[model samples]
Target: MKFIIVTGVSRGLGLGLTKALLSSGYKVAGCSRSRSDALNELEMSNDNFKWFPCEVGDATQTQTFVSDACQWAQAPLWGLINNAGIAKEGVLATFPNVDSDELLQINLNGALYMAREALRMMLRQNSGGRIINISSIIGSRGYTGLAAYSASKAGLDGLSRALARENGRRGITVNSVAPGYLDTEMSSTLSDSKRAQIINRTPLGRLGTVDDVAPAIEFLLSDGAAFITGQTLTIDGGITN
Candidate 1:
């Protein structure tokens, strides 16, 4: 079975993506800052699924996580999903310096560390692989109060484009998925009015779902998408338009 690495698998979109990948018969190496009961249950049920606790922002920890994953899989990696990220919201003028730094560490540096290690493994395997970075619609279209978050995500998109160019010759493809507001815990804190406003603005008249996003990710990792790289696929219900 092909092995895939998915970070931030303890909850929300990460959890949904892990479940979807496992269901589709890929061996998944997943990680999060802490172990959740849901992830433990998944581990117990799926022999193909392994969970590693990691702080993706830490380069050493991330590298160790990927190395251990390679050992555990005992095979070449087929794909990687740099899905670990944290959201920090504040007006650009007063956004705490600490929060801004922390946001970029997790959202951008984390992906960088993980992708660097994953690329090492993929290169050693001498086989083409897929790397999918999870971004935000806010990256392309700025949102008030999310300037730091948007900057980090926009950096991730730029990273994807550069890596796609650098690694294409190695048979590895790099791309990103930018999703708008989804019906996940991250969006639960928004006020009802705010949520309604977002939905009304979405041409689909609803928030995006994990189900809606996971399938697109799955497709991007498939052979069909071999020719599609250095691109950002936005799943925002046309809100960015």
Candidate 2:
């Protein structure tokens, strides 16, 4: 069985990806800062799913979580999805004192910690593996109020490329999935008019669903993507184009 570790599995895109992976018969181990009621309910019924309460930004906590997961599952870890992130909005000039620091701690540093530990595990196993970082379209393109969020995700994209090159010889393929505006809690605060405006600009004429993002991730984790690495697969409904 393919064993996978996904972070931020409490809600939104993370939760959706967890459900999809479970339905596809993969053994999934996930972590979140706090367990959601929905995740608890799903855990009650799914034998192949395990959820951990972990703060991915902390190096010690991240290491412990992966260690425990490997011990409990006793399986070769095939994939690691660094999906935990935070979005804080503010223009570069007048951003609040704590905004930039907090956003980077979670969105960028957390991903680095998880990727480090996951790569260590995969190396020891001596088998090919996949590492998928969940970035954002804003990572590549700048927006007015999303300076901190954009910077962090941009860092993630660079990290993915570097890791892909470093670990390619070990059969580990590192990549990123950059998604555009998706209809999730993260984008819920936008006004309906604003949402419609974004949709109008997208070639698909709609905001992407979590489903659209999950399949790209699943495909990257599959054997078919063995030749693909150091790339960012953008699922933006052509918004970037």
Off by over 4 Å in 2: none
* TM-score of candidate 2 on Cα atoms, chains taken together: 0.98
- The 10-residue segment with the lowest total lDDT in model 1: 86-95
All candidates' lDDT scores? 0.95, 0.93
* Poorly placed runs, candidate 1 (over 4 Å): none
The weakest ten consecutive residues by lDDT in model 2 span 88-97
Candidate 1, residue 33: the lDDT equals 97
Our tally of clashes for model 1 stands at: 0
Clashes per candidate (backbone, < 3 Å): 0, 0
- Candidate 1's residue-wise lDDT over 1-241, tens digit each? 8899999999999999999999999999999999999999999999999999899999999999999998999989999999999887779899899999999999999999999999998998899999999999999998899999999999999999999999999889999999999999888889999999999999999999999999999999999999999999999999988
Per-residue lDDT of 23-89 in model 2, one digit per residue for the tens? 9889999999998898998899898888998999899999999999888778999999999998888
